[model samples]
Target: MIQLVVSIILYFVIFFGIAFILNMLLRRTWLMAFLYPFVVLIIVDNMSTMEYLKAPGSAFSEAFSRLMQITPVDIAILVAGFAGTIVSGIIIKLLRKSGYQMF
Candidate 1:
């Protein structure tokens, strides 16, 4: 239980920090949120980018199977990471609204 909580918080903080920096540097509030799924895909799927391109059908099938096999705790961690990205976007938007320059 402790480990799960730590994992969730760790993923949230890691994703939040990364997304916050990305939002500032790119000056796009939701860029990280939009790209989070691809980030998750890279984390979840074992296939390399080249493998995905070379054998898209097989790679996608394998990825789907892997995704289906993920545990509930893993899903929760991923959701936390996704929430971090979204919260980062909202924070950036709010900061900009308050006249703070993100870039």
Candidate 2:
């Protein structure tokens, strides 16, 4: 619902902002673009924990534990993070191609 949409939007905003800053700092660096998605994975994982769990201390271990079940919202956040990373990369590539500098 609305919360999921908001979370996804927030994920995109953060992911894009980070990627954009890195892209500006490391121009012509494909590694950063490729690694952005993985970075988003970690960020979104943390964000998901904050969103869902009252006890944030255990969120990190719980987020990664395959044995510990995750909710649909977590999955959605992961998916959104991945999608945002990809979109950001593509947008950056296009911007570079068009010679429009952004940060």
TM agreement with the true structure for every prediction = 0.93, 0.60
Off by over 4 Å in 1: none
Which 10-residue window in model 2 sums to the lowest lDDT? 60-69
Task: Tell me which residue pairs clash in candidate 2.
Answer: none
Clashes in model 1: which pairs?
A: none
Runs of candidate 2 exceeding 4 Å displacement: 28-63, 66-68, 101-103
lDDT of 1 at 23: 91
Report lDDT (CA) for all predictions.
Answer: 0.90, 0.65
lDDT of 1 by residue, 30-94 (tens): 88888988888888888788878899899888887888888999999999999999888898889
